[model samples]
Target: MSNAEMILELVRKNNGVVTAAEVTQAGISRGSLNHLVNSGLLEHASRDVYQLAEVWDNEMYQLQIRYKKGIFSGKTALFLNDLTDRTPIRFHMTFPLKYNIGVLKKQNVKCNRTKP
Candidate 1:
């Protein structure tokens, strides 16, 4: 199969989402991601994540992809883990004690830090 085909296959396997890091790990070049985006087959979802153009924007998934170090917590975790039926008004995430939270706060995420 062609490079584009391989990339599309990867996206399909990933529930219509894929990341540049994943592509590189699969031995694919980032150019394939750009090509797919240019062709309108995929849309940039975040800094390094892409999704099928037709897929609805999953905010939680996108945030998780964008901040790999941020772990869902509190009400957000309850909703994500199916422990609650109500959606959280704000996303809650926890990062390491020393991790920078400026960017996460800019995204409107409720940032929490682990105890050192």
Candidate 2:
């Protein structure tokens, strides 16, 4: 399949979201990603993150994609595990030590650090 087709397929498979690393690993060029954005086929979600334009995205899923090591912890985990009746107001994500959280900061994510 062509690079563009492969990228689109990745997005489709991932519930309408894709990451730049995934694209690059598939041998698709960054210029293709730019083209998709410019052509309105994809919307940049955050740094290295893209979503199918206008699709509803799950924040937890997006966070996982954006930060591979991040996991729902604390309040967010309780809610997800049905151990808490109250809904979590913010995502509580824990990433391994030394993980860069620049993207999470940009998205106003509540992040914590942990040992791998």
Candidate 3:
């Protein structure tokens, strides 16, 4: 298979979360990624991140995208905590003090970087 096809398969297996670093590690060039996006075979969900349009329905993929954006935490942590309950409308994520929490907060996701 071609590098782009291989990379696409990798993203599919990973629930649609693939980083540019990962693509390089997989021997795919950054140019190929740009080509895929331009071709509508892939979409940029975050900086340096790409996902296939096919797996967009996968909740895990959505979660990973949110996590990448720093808006996944709190009640959303319940998923990571092994608590079975209703899914949260907003996710919570913590960031280091040096990192700005503005984007997450703006998304209406709770930010608690100060907490453990």
- How far residue 99's Cα lies from its native spot in candidate 1, in Å, is 1.1
Kindly report which residue pairs in candidate 2 clash with one another: none
Model 3: weakest 10-residue lDDT segment is: 57-66
Instruction: Choose 1 or 2, whichever is better by TM-score.
Output: 1
lDDT of each: 0.90, 0.85, 0.72
Q: After the best TM-score superposition of candidate 3, give how far the Cα of residue 16 lies from its true spot, in angstroms.
A: 3.5
* 1-116: candidate 2 lDDT, tens digit per residue: 87777888999998889889988888889888888899899998877889999788677777777677788899999999999899888889998889988767767579899887
The sequence of per-residue lDDT tens digits that candidate 3 reaches over residues 1-116 is 98778888888888777888888998778999999999999988766778777755545445455465354467777876779568777666766656676655666466776532
Q: Which 10-residue window of candidate 2 scores lowest in summed lDDT? A: 57-66
TM-score winner among the candidates?
A: 1
What lDDT score goes with residue 13 in model 2? 95
Order of all candidates by TM-score, from best down to worst? 1, 2, 3
**2 against 3, candidate with superior lDDT:** 2
In candidate 1, which residue pairs get closer than 3 Å at backbone N, Cα or C atoms, i.e. clash? none
CA displacement after TM-score superposition, residue 75 of candidate 3 (Å): 1.8
TM-score of each: 0.89, 0.81, 0.66
